[model samples]
Target: MTEGTIPAALDRAAEHFAGREALVDGEVRLSYAELARRVRQAARFFEGHERVAICSPNTWHWVVAGLGALYAGATLVPVNTRFTARETIDILERARVSALVITGTFLGTDRLADLGSARPGTVLRIPVEGVEEPISGVTEWDALTGLDSDFVSPAEPDGVSDILFTSGTTGRGKGAMSSHRQALSVAGAWADCGGLTEQDRYLVINPFFHSFGYKAGIVAAVLRGATMLPQRTFDVRETLRLIETEHVTVLPGAPTIHQVLLDAPERANHDLSSLRLAVTGAATVPVALVERMQTELSFDTVLTAYGLTEAVVATMSRPGDDAKLVANYTGRATAGFEVKLGEHDEVLLRGPNVMLGYLDDPDATAKAVDTDGWLHTGDVGVLNERGYLKIVDRIKDMYVCGGFNVYPAEIEQVLSRLDGVAESAVVGVPDQRLGEVGKVFVIPRTGSALSTEDVIAHCEGELANYKIPRFVDFVAELPRNLSGKVLKRVLRKENG
Candidate 1:
């Protein structure tokens, strides 16, 4: 096996920990040897393909399909299972994918059926939970998993391994091409910082399409021989049950997951004593929340990580850092990474984990990463005396209010601390006088009557008048992408 290729790493893990638990999805469990054998078999089935697109929910099959694609020496393109038919078609066309592996149905959505004729080629359907009736003219995923296990393919260390599509918040999403070496760099960084081991049972709540899950969640666990428990969606009860039943030791997700877990009435009923490592991040992580995670959630350490799709595992808070710093600031740069604030406080990064470039789009790639090796992260941040990065907000997410640049993240952080607020997002909208003012959309706590007036009163002393949101709207939930990032573009379209 090639040294830097993913199959090489999997082969090592399988050889060393053949009997160890490797994956758990629903009732099915796979040991390292079994999983690696399946990966090699699936690779043989997919040999001679240049690119393979995978659209599946969080399951053991998803991991197998992804690894199989890599082992086959094909570039893997992971499409969001939640994407619309048009969005799915657009990505396949962009990548010029020769083969496709998709799920049947999940959460009342038939991902494969919905694609319809959009993708009408060699399609392999993974038997997911919802779709009972077998679809016609599609190859079964299980058939491919039973093929020959011994196969080696040629793959350069610098060869592109995966093409991860961006969230497409601003425009049509671009695929960030990542090489085999870059993937290992990201996976290793997460493994070292997370302290992953064979004893750990990692529960990944993030989507498989996102870097947070694909790289940091699964790849990291695979590299360290940790048992993986992937959750399709975040449910307070389900997550607690998984942790209790599986003895989950590592769980990483967005802040919203923790907030719901911390506030669940039945939370006390679950035996979450097995949880020792917790990782969460957002634009603004409340210090109080981190404290509660450590004390209330029984996590040994609560870490906040910062990275983009273009570069995974850039900066992460260390275990012994100050609690306030761990909560609010994205810790020092990872090894082999040079992080600094560029023009206008934009985060500039140069690291081994930086992606190859945006696939087929040289202009976008050039604008994002300059010739001098620095990838221009559009996020605006401050480097404090301790060299920890305090993220203010996305430069694109920032809006001007009354001639003063207002970062919605700062205001949202203050709002998150308010008594009755469950979660909140601030988006800039057209104002008659101020030109652009914040229009805050808030999700009120369960059973609590949190009125717009109450929100206004809470913000009186916490923020400046110009920084305060002029319009307040209450909603059951904020619109978010697969990775749990708030869709401010949708908010602006709804309220602007």
Candidate 2:
């Protein structure tokens, strides 16, 4: 049996489930043997490039390209698909990347033209389902993956497999390095945690760049025998149709995904009996939503997991946990990891799942992962007597009201339970009397009249007066990054 890395795992899967469906993208379906052949064929094309990047949405070509990079002994870098031309190249330059396999014009952005020599590399453009012609001066993705080459690089268990950038909610994103072993360990742990099996059909809604979709979504499915069905973007109607038509068994995404499903009007019309497992995470989860997932959505196993780009899949709820465990806490440390709280209740973690460090930024890395190897995940949370974790909020997201500390997540949790509220975000806005007070922006459920008074009144007895939002503003939606994190910085700057 091949061991210690993704390539090894792929070889094993190809041998075991070679004839089974390995990938499904719209009408294209490839068996494990064909997928492995493409990976091996594409691997021979890398030619030992020092660094390669993939800036594409969820698609089968992205999967083959990424796996081929690994097998070619190249360090794989994932650039955010939402990044602008300049923003994307800035990362490629920082990493000194020599190759980039980017997508064609996608979702209103010409990802290829965005590069424009800002960071020079052997640029390769992958045309998605519809686009048939390859751009001039770029290698055709089909021509590359079609070659049947007998090649496999040596196992690189300790070598860096990926350099995932921080979400950069605050400022410039920092690249975090993960070894082949560390990355694969997270994938294996997630597959086991979710009880994924060969019979599973996984629909990946999260982007390929994020840790959730890259390691947990794509790699985990390959490690197990699950069929991968990639979605480019999250559209409510499209997601429901895929779930019903494809019989997607395992669908994992951010909490917003589940919330949308629960709130969608045509939900009852679709026969979604195949959605058996769902994995989600957020700052605050209302218990009612969890119940609705199990009862209304008919999900047999609904889990909430916690992890950052630095350490993906740290903790996750398990099957048969109570509503409180499923909705309240992010669950105890997943297998092969340790979790503790720092002085101010910041969640501290250390394990194989943890990243090596921020690439080429030792000072920032030293500050995050202490000399003892504990990664200080800036997010704050509390562990109950039973050891379940309830994430309060980002420590930086917390603010003082009337000289008392207040956490936005605590208030948001209360706000979500209120009638007519679909979602809410609380940020500290300037206030004369208290230095800084909470200002909440809410998105009302469809067809409901949620007023500012309705929001303020809902928090009356449910929260401390200091924690209550002094100002309430109803908006169509809160500004969020592609990863589904509320851009509180944007909120703070707008309301500052």
Candidate 3:
């Protein structure tokens, strides 16, 4: 019950679930006892000074590494698996990372090669199972799992325990340092808000590298003593099959996953009656998509959350709220946080969940987190009289035309509602007369005759003249990452 660490909560879960299944990946089922043992070995392995970097796939391997690293009273650095070697190298060096625990190929770059040798004052490589060993000093992840599991770790309740990396589109990635106390607080907050308990079986299909997955998938599940069903990669059919067979109680993913499942032909065949709670976050959810997901999937309980990497986890739509409110707003923004509108309508957040600071980058941290300790969220939002926060768009994504500011999300939301539009990304383009103009990149529904004018016309009726996209480009599909977030930067570079 101390400040920074979560070992106590993990212990509590172990005692509560002991022989019960804690993790399931295909044929790999690890009970709470077995998981606890491996975690102890990890703690024992890290008896020295306080942190190790974890860069692994979204399998059981990742879970073991994260838990073990935490057991050692060490903070964990979760490196993005999709980063290129150059990007990975820049983050590792910037974080001043000590040891590394990595797995198989990530975006075609070997973990060790991508991570490279640790810099001076850095401990070399530590391999996370079934992979090649280090060129110099390296420890096998499996070897630690086999070590004696009875080691008792010292409690440092309020210490920094994890460094999760967040990519800055403008520059190098920043490491958001989260304490064990802060991390577990987030898990507890999620459980309390979502009504999670031991009876719930949570299915985790999101990438563990992201804050939403890490908090909801690992930490929250442990705090609630709930079982975790993890997938290496998300496949709509496979996920539905698991939900039907495993009697999954909780389903959590980004809006994209739900959209894909809604379109999947097999979605209706599966018996998803056991799925009670469905939690979604990361990107904005279309109101129509939320309704369809509820009606089609028969989700008994549904909630949408909103937060950023710096906060680890911040806001959630309280369980039992109106479906329309849950679909449209980012909840009440949580009690631990404070939010205010900055210049240009930017939303700023300050709270315990917000990270201490970015590692080794005071300049970037200062720019993000002001002297008043408020982290500018770069998101533009409007707070209704009821206190619900509906995000309008990112600060950079908002375009100005003549004089009026145009929120791309507001425009994109309208475009997405059009009959033949599959997905859309809105950006600002330079204009001759007007200061700027809206440009829409759209993906049409298969076999539909949707044109640029059609999309522009749809927006014209739904949005203001200044807000309507002046140029609309039809593409087969929009560029997105694994999490279903449209990569606007990719579209901008391609069209700019």
Candidate 4:
């Protein structure tokens, strides 16, 4: 593995794979040397910022801005693109982000303007859909080109590289901080497991904000000098088209993504023979889905992995794992991690790749990562005799919705603020397409008329799309135990 910081890795990539294609985004194509040069230019523009944030979808701009920020010795903060303006602003404020790289207007929303007074001191807007004219206050993505490129980063391998925020059971988001070495360590482990190579063309459909996309997708591709083809959003047709056209060899995302691709009616129309590797997890991976990926999708190797924002790339299935093992187990620990079942069968992980700590929350950090260096992952799992891990349940009331973690407390907190809601409880209900979707049981205030539409509408403004409840059921009261705790198990049984 390459030593030193991420910028050092990029420099190594520039020298080793100078002529090889590094990025392919829409009409843009850049070789390794060209990509490094562009990153240096963007780095010059971001040099002064302490905390830089990227709040855009998966695009060339996102890659450049993120890498550039790291190269400039800034701690990168990735904001979820699906987050509402309010949610985004809250992140920016809490993180104390000084600079922001955001989209101009995407999906009929002017994100730059949406920031309002909470906008960072410096903002660079990427025009995903060509803007008619540059915004008044924001700098255009292209504007960074004129900046001086002869810049040397002050970043160190042990320095904080990024702050990835994960929601807690308390509904508050906790930023998980990782050093440059820790970040690259996990990416290297994942790349090695998938057997990623320079010749591989990676089609990154996962959002760049999550660890799966940023660390495992982009960072892993960079480590191996693999060509990255980032898709802004997941569209089945576009995915198939890219696979056929780009000869995409590496595709890693949620099982839902591959499931949709395999089930797409138009799948046969495209020549998908180029796909060789498929890495999936974050939801239940049926044995049938694993079999179909190899048989129908022509993926030579299909693997399943398990990870969390705190300890990215903890466990992963190897290349030759059988369908049953690949689907049923998240293979043994990698990335120098020691995995064990803690109290109540909680998955406890201790490793070099574990995050340094939750940003500025020592109490929370101490609770998560014990003195013995074990990260108490609030996931219940079982380890087989062969050392394979099978995650059975969550110790915390959190669920994975389409590969993104959705904490019920966050949604419940938002619902508590609604005008007509007296009390509410949210749970994850099984969904065929997304694996799981949120369902909220509400107890309306007396004499207050609250419809399902009202509940959904209230959440739409306050929460992300995935966090919003799919089913809104009005109930007179919630079932509780002798301890006065809401019996979520009872609700799940009744709902089931």
The candidate scoring highest on lDDT is 4
Q: List the pairs of residues colliding in candidate 1.
A: none
Candidate ranking under TM-score, highest first, comes to 4, 1, 2, 3
* Weakest 10 consecutive residues of candidate 2 by summed lDDT: 165-174
Alpha-carbon TM-score of each model against the true structure: 0.81, 0.80, 0.76, 0.99
Candidate lDDT scores, in order, read: 0.83, 0.82, 0.74, 0.92
* Candidate 1: residue 290 Cα off by (Å): 0.3
Residue 162 lDDT (model 3): 80
> What's the distance in Å from true for residue 364, model 3?
2.7
Ranked by lDDT from best down, the candidates are 4, 1, 2, 3
Q: In candidate 3, what are the lDDT values of residues 71-98, reduced to their tens digit?
A: 7777777776655455566666776666
lDDT of 2 by residue, 185-243 (tens): 88888898899999999999888888888999878998898999999888889989999
> Which prediction has more favorable TM-score, 1 or 2?
1
Clashing pairs in 2: none
The clash tally of candidate 2 reads 0
Tens-digit lDDT track for model 4 on 296-339? 99999999999999998899999889999999999999999999
**Models, CA RMSD each:** 10.6, 10.9, 11.1, 1.2
- In model 3, what lDDT does residue 312 have? 56
